[model samples]
Target chain A: MTSKSTSPRRRQQPPIALVILAVAGIAVFIVPLIGLLARTPWRDLPALLTSDVVVDALRISFIASIGATAISAVLGVPLAWLLARVEFPGRSIVRGLVVLPLVLPPVVGGAALLFALGRRGIIGGPLHQMTGLVLPFSIWGVVIAATFVAMPFLVITVEGALRNLDPRFEGAAATLGAGRWTVLRRVTLPMIGPSLAAGLALAWARALGEFGATITFAGNLQGRTQTLPLAVFVALETDRGAAVALSLIMVVISLTVLIVLRERWWRPL
Target chain B: MNPLAGLDAHLVVSRGDEFTLDIRLRVPRGKTVALLGPNGAGKSTVVAALAGLLPLEQGHIALDGRTLDDPDDGVLVPAEERGVGVVFQDYVLFPHLTVVDNVAFGLRSRNVKRGPSTAEAKRWLERFGIADLAGRKPGDLSGGQAQRVALARALITDPDLLLLDEPLAALDATTRVDLRRTLTDHLAQFSGPRMVITHDPTEAFLLADEIHVIENGAITQVGTPDDIRLRPRTPYIADLAGSNLFIGTAHEGTVTVGDHQISVADRHIDGPVLAAVNPRAIVISLAEPGGSSRNSWNTRVERIEHYGDRVRLQTGAPLPLTAEITPAALDDLRIAEGSPVWVSIKATEISVERD
Candidate 1:
């Protein structure tokens, strides 16, 4: 009995069941934020933020996360371009391996890293003998763990953008006397600027919030390996007020970064 | 020097069983050749091969005495080093860059300084009468404007060879007319040999000094536009050139078509011959009152189409023929679809060619 005009009305307002599901979805995400805000020690926030343990963890977190993001940007973008543009034997397999960290548990990723680069590990053993470097239980180890868990975000984002790019532009550039390097540097990268920004932001945020890999591989050290997430975990056992304060700080920082990135980069073309 | 010393190519591109393009063409410097073919007849493949975008399965391509591709010698220059420019059918301007930058891309890639390249690009834009749109993105331009931008981008490289793939196919009728004029001017200014790929015969005849007719991945004929119009070898070319073609075996001056024999006053061809009849030369009548035209047939109107002031009638066969008549004649005879009619044409009107 439905008419065409009424069908438009039906489309304008989704089914009641779907509306209820949407409300439930929002509640699932927003309720946690509300809980964190309510638990925040607002009266003691300033004091808790300035405490020695919080300051040390925050400094460590900043250094490790930014380091991890820098490494990922330098290496991951090229890997993304390769995965998207090249056709070689075992290409699909290489692509799968690049995205494995996104699905693997962070603790397992840390364990795999440990086996490969630990003091007594396969490649790490020769490295320690030659250069006297031991990575596990150190600040560098923390950055490595963060990169293992977060680099995949940047790679996947940039790779998807690269794959969807209209290759005709490259063809046109080639015919216009551009060498392969020039086209990649000037034309291809500049065109995908927004997606690159988006990928960098996602990777940076993931690095900042990394918890399991940092704890498993780097181990908790008060002024070195313990990032904000690890500090929150240890603080929750003895100082609930400090833990809530640190979590609030982390939430606010990430929210501000994401909003800034969206405004600057992801505007509709 | 030989006249065919500009852009010469003989190539075979195989796309499995779906299609294959086997073509041989040449265009001397300051000349334009049109590769005219129907859709899916592999005109684009020829353009791609010439530009070094697609590798040839066999044969070689050379431009201005330099070998661009030769499978036997392993002297295949990459597309970026081929010194060839192309304006794709869709005018594939970069969606991200400004109009001026898109045009200056070629110069910039060759390490020319920014100031000179931008100035040169701007001048080209002014010539295209689109200097006002220099800062605008391609998404903001109309179809005709985009076409001009594509042309400017290609020509800025000063390439030794240029290829245009259906440059006018993406525009509306009025815009196509305007852009076609602009393209003619630019082609005159470019010194290199240029090849234009198009399916429109009017576009080909208007712009090209020579036409290469391709059908089913092979070049059936290569001649001037008038030559192609006067004698179209294939039925597809005949339709495109607006002539009705009848292919049959000939004995002396008589050609056997289907179940009927028509006498043609042409050179005596012993075996198979192609007979081309101008559609306008054939007259239609309600009654059989033809005096001297022994070349007459009884036919029924299959369809009638209006083309400006003329009505073209497609008729049923002993030998199916398309004939054009004045609209007034159409009304006087009262011919509609399925109306039985007599078609008459003099023997001298039919041009015969050895097949």
Candidate 2:
């Protein structure tokens, strides 16, 4: 049986031309990472990384990205559940609006946020008058901008997982005397834990790498809104070594997160 | 009947473009009723309706005289508050929780603290003979082990009514036989009105005091195991139990079923009676043979079914009945469906019982 199976498997190999094309596809993703590694200033890395600009940018990026992930978990999970489980009018329209950011340009999303929440804009003007506060070019602005662009990853992922779950588990839980809140907290949440974790990681990664939205909606200031991406953008012209160091830091963080979450994200693929 | 006795339910629910389920059931305290039916016969619908998962369009359900559902009066109790414990098909154990935690879930859901709930769950697991599997997740347990955990979880809540849906359908043949004995013992300990839903006649007969045979969203017959086996009312039940039943008037030594008469050894039975003839008791031949048997008929074969070493044929003619023969005998007779054959049954093989 083993010999007969092996013979057919060997005969089913792909053509050499397709194999060559597949190798070229793989090279397209790897060549750029090799280029970045070749240009690194190995000896001056510590000094370049510890500079005041890089340190401040690191702090702001951490705050904004982590804050965005927390807010997304709070708001996105319920939204995903409602979309997957409930039926109401205009639900498709609401879902399409929620997913609009994933396909919309980041600059356009930032501009839309400015129109809705900027100091001189509609809700922002009345709020500013009441609280005597400003929002644009602040640390809060960076978090809001990151959340706007990053939350759809969490929503769509969680919604898909919710859609695929067998509802019989929830029904069984109910028959076991579990109320609605207890059932959701104990059964529904844990069953989707892997997908939730994967969504959070993807959202955090996207938030950490945010550049266009932050620059458009939140101005680039050293300790306020200048995330790693913006700091790298600013240093690319005058300080190439510092830019390389900042890029390397982001690469390391994103790579570590992806590796830690590889099992959850890779299984479905 | 006492008003505050046990479960008394009349369920009428309609699904769009599909069949409407309309069944009336009553189980006194400390009795088991089996809803036996084939697939698509709405056995699950009965479970869902009684458990408060599906509301009835008409009729009312009362457990110990407390109304659970009445569409006319607009009283519908949710599933969690109904106190109906259902062991769903395939168990549906929580995959993320350990065996102990899954069993403890009922108590925890009722606001019992974790420490006490865990202690109680461990005791239940010990009673089920699975205390060693407490820490293992559902994915690590076998089918029988999962079934025990599911039972433990349902019984922990002290429900007013217990429902087991196809409990033994998921187990292997050997495990099913072993677990069935365990299940019988456990079910005897629960002091409540219980219902077992299954398609297997043997399981129904073994586990239930009374059986309700459902077909196409309706109950066709409700009786004891002996009643269903000896006097099947419908062709489906007769075929299921594999008993060729004849209901007719009995004379001194013979019973006239339809246009034909069957001879039995009993000479005193008279009036209406039910006669059962086992398919294996009938002998089939291609040609007429002289024999000591008192009954013989020339019939055509309507259907032929092979069951491993033996073959069962449905005979069509003046006396339509089922006859079983060995495969070698069937080959020697050179018969197929629609072939003419001779069937004979000894007078001593017929069992006569009151209708």
Candidate 3:
């Protein structure tokens, strides 16, 4: 019989078992990161880093990711607000569909993007016929592809934040002589600023690392369409060291920005 | 400017098989009324309807002589155009904006540019004694500070009707009591109609000139605080009535119950009447012979609950009664559950009314 007076002894795991479990998780993630750092050619690193192709890929990645982020904010934030606040028919279905990209493979998402925005696509055909512009293998196409894949990240983040916010704040804004558009611009947007930043960061990361959709739709060119991820993928076929080095740069940039973001804004209330 | 200065609402709301707010009330300019109710008494519904957040099922809402909502006339003012300020239950402060920015939000919406809006916000913050904390976000402030900011933001636009929905329920007891006076001062300074919803009688009494008690979705009584606290009709009302009331048959000068003839303070044509007595009014003694109090009975103590300064004795005789006594009296008499004691009350202490 167990009594309240006597202290309970903790069950211990075997040293071997603990070591094995830790090794499994580490080998999948930490080991690969260590491999990248170790395999980096310190002698050829400077020459490879100074290359114009690498510089252009980095520039394209930054510009496209930022463009995707801004576009997502303009479109996705409102969509998120609508999803959270509006009470219309098929709302539950719309919410489920908004999070659909998160569970899907990026490559399959690229293929679906191709079918929709291809020359003969429903709306794409009209645009191509009227304006003599086919978006395939273009920088703008890369942005569209990255946006389609990354926007859901922003939408989901903002939607969750909006759902948690009390609806009364909107009412308070309305009573203060604010119209619908004004409440969205002044009150609702500022209130969810942190969630918006978090959403932007995630979307930027997703857009920057986009290899499948960009290559599939925009067809990884030398400088125009080739982002850092596409450059790394192309380099993998020729020089493995160069591929690792490109990935390391992307990793360093993302990790540094993420650290800064967390320090400035994600503190516990 | 919004023309909702004096809101007169003939409100009708029904949900499911029960609950309705089919009552009419008018809030005059420059006065405060409290909506007091239990948990699900549709108190918030009234505020929501007035604010135009919830579409009313029926009735007419006219503010400042302009119709806001009239289902019969197809008149409904949009929530954005209603111009009825609200301080929500959770404070609902914009988590991202600083105190100044959150306050400025209202003025900014009124087409006053940023420079003027923030100046007005700063002025309001100074009035609330929170100008020093104006740069800080809502997440940085304490509960009391946040609530003041919410009130300030709601009032900054000088709205016609201000609705506060359980604004102090989120506060600690000490802070709640202290904030009541500050809120009262603010309400007095404002010249618009105000409605405050609260479940606490103490809060309602402190803030409201007129009190409306809602029970099971209907306005059961609307009166002064004294009236609601003393002359409660329903059980929910009696719960707030402070004094304990019991219904019993009156025979001659005595009332028969559980094999005992109990004397009543009430006289003249009496079949049944509710005996009202304050728990503090009854005196408990150890002696069985009782006293010259005119109404005394041999009672068996059922239970004893110790309050901070006093003890409530729930005793059983012909009728079960609860009496509040000081701890010293309880200690001296050694009062405990199942003890045989004599309970006495002055005839003047008891008041009887028809049930």
Candidate 4:
């Protein structure tokens, strides 16, 4: 039945080298996961994950990642709409700056954020003096750093969706006496729901896996600012078993998110 | 001057360096005016301008004694405040909403309570005879059903002006006839100014009270159906009106069109039908010629018009039709206005289709 369903031309065997390389590509991702599984201490996994350092890291990771995702959504959606719809001078420059964090090294982004918002830095000096507050080496710094590195994912996804949407749907709504806000809330946003979901998932995953920016900007304080990746980094130097356990947790989370969102990310909306 | 009662607008908009639309339109209360033009003839531009989706670069638009857009005076009412209900091409219904929610959207946007809006929307669905489809999404509807939903959504807002852009251009031929009748009934019920934008000459002639012939961003002629049909000002309108359309009841192989009866080639069609006869298919002779043709009549020439290499004779009497003949044939027959002529058409030449 399979042979009858597929055309004869499509049933032809692919080239040998192409097949070999495709298998190699699959193996490249699978090999490291297999290695991690081989090294996992399954019986001691629950005890290691429940330790104080691990528990604190888990709480901090959840707070920082979810908080960053919320912030990104609030600020990035409107920024994306502006870039997609409005025509302004230097608009391309603003778009390039939004996308810079994606391709730039995370460490570089952390440094840039530090220079802008550090205690003694340009705006940070006045901010600290006026409010008697500091941002670096705190949980707030972790969220900021994560957002700086992860928000581009959401902005780019939503911008592309907005650009591809038919403007006539919004026009129809407006002609129906819907105000601008109502049209955006009712028509434009719902029509781009799939892409927005995909963008949020991608951004959350990126924030969960963040290491360099968090460690560089927020510092590695075990109970205050240390997150999962920072905990892994600290454990790698002192205890290899805890490091492996943390890595396994991250692997499980990332895999589950990807499996759930595979269709949205890989296919055209 | 007395305040205008309905829509009164002069639209002038320039897009870049290549195209500029400049036209004036006046649709009185309780009248349907059609802006008829072919593709790229600025039909969409007119729709957009009237719906307040695009601002006029120059000129004023006044509806029911109120000014909507006047560029020189810096008065521009945004689309949301224009009180215009538009059924866009292809309907453009929100895919995420159910039929009830889609209908209720206009009321919801006006700050109406959810319970009242839903009840009102359901009543409208019942009025349109689609109450059972209230729970279904737009993607699940047929083309005709979707058009009804679009109409309901637009009309629920109770706007002062209703605009339909190619309302039936998306449906199949069989569905179009039924939907056109439904649309005609709906248009009659709306007592506000209504405008229909279409490229189909038959739709414009049948649906609108006044026809505005637009070409190259300008209106060339404005008149009633018969005036536009018989005294076309441009070659484009001449070409469009050249085909004669007759709606009649068919029995066996014969169709009764108004006062005259004509034989059609399709013997199996036995209901109301639309028959089309091209001007070229009609043969004109000075005397009654005997041939295999089944339909021939003695008629007087009411008008004679020449359109580039061809002469069209507007015949009067028992059957009125325009027949195209070469300039040489006109010289040979020496036929002029008020001349008696014999018109004959083979039954096979008349194309008949279900109305």
Top TM-score hit? 4
Ranked candidates (lDDT, high to low): 4, 2, 1, 3
- Candidate 2 local lDDT, A178-241, one digit each (tens): 9999999999999988888888988999999988888988989988899999999999997999
Interface RMSD of each: 1.0, 0.7, 1.6, 0.6
The Cα error of candidate 4 at residue B213, in Å, is 1.0
For residues B182-290, write the lDDT of model 3, one tens digit per residue: 8888878678888889998767876888888888877889898766654554556655655655556776666554465556665673776556688888888998544
State the lDDT of candidate 4 residue by residue for B162-239, as single tens digits.
999999999998899888888898888788999999999888988999999999899999999888887777889988
- Supply DockQ values for each candidate: 0.59, 0.62, 0.61, 0.88
lDDT of 1 by residue, B41-76 (tens): 899788778887788888999998889999888888
- Give the Å error, residue B190, model 4: 0.7
On the 0 to 100 scale, the lDDT of residue B211 in model 2 is 95
Q: What's each prediction's TM-score?
A: 0.81, 0.82, 0.77, 0.97
Q: Where does candidate 3 stray beyond 4 Å?
A: A1-16, A265-269, B1-5, B16-18, B129-132, B243-355
lDDT of 4: 0.90
TM-score of the second chain of model 3 compared to its true counterpart: 0.69
lDDT of 1: 0.87
Q: Identify the runs in model 2 with alpha carbons over 4 angstroms from their true place.
A: A1-13, A264-269, B243-355
Interface RMSD after interface superposition, model 3: 1.6
Query: How would you encode candidate 1's per-residue C-alpha lDDT over A65-139 as one tens digit per residue?
Result: 899999999999999988998888998898889889888999998888888889888988898999999888899
Native contacts kept, each candidate: 0.84, 0.80, 0.90, 0.90
- Model 1 deviation from native, Cα RMSD in Å: 10.8
